[model samples]
Target: MEVKRMTDREIVFRLLRYEQANLRNYQNYLAYTKNKDLSAYIARTIPQIEGNIKSLNVLSRKLCGG
Candidate 1:
């Protein structure tokens, strides 16, 4: 089996997709969790994920020319 390398754009796309997926999961968990502590934890974690997504989105836009 041979490994394939990804270009910078491909890597950025994958990272953005993964971060979006995590954001969705955290949103769902925060919305549906019955335990208050768990919900709070999810809420706390979500902002970091959101910040990463925002940064990646900016990078993607920069790569794509605004």
Candidate 2:
């Protein structure tokens, strides 16, 4: 089997897309969970997830020469 290498732009775009999806999932979990501890944990994680998305967006912009 062979793997294809991705360009920096491609990599950043894929990562940004994936992180955005994960952030949405986390937001949904936070909205639906009833347990207090679980809610707290998810709330804490949401900021980290948002940070990741922000970082990825920056990288994507840089890669695209924006």
Q: Which predicted model would earn the best lDDT?
A: 1
lDDT of each: 0.92, 0.90
User: For every model in order, what is the number of clashing pairs?
Assistant: 0, 0
Maximum-TM-score candidate: 2
Per-candidate RMSD, Å:
1.5, 1.2
What are the runs in model 1 whose C-alpha is more than 4 Å off? Answer: none
Which residue ranges in model 2 land beyond 4 Å of their true spot? none
State the displacement of the C-alpha of residue 66, model 2, in Å, after optimal TM-score superposition: 1.0
Per-residue lDDT of 1-66 in model 2, one digit per residue for the tens? 899998988888888889899999999999999999999999999999899989988887787788
lDDT of 1 by residue, 2-65 (tens): 9998877788889999999999999988888899999889989999999999999999888887
Tell me the deviation in Å of residue 13 in model 2: 0.8
Q: Give TM per candidate.
A: 0.84, 0.89
The pairs that clash in candidate 2 are none
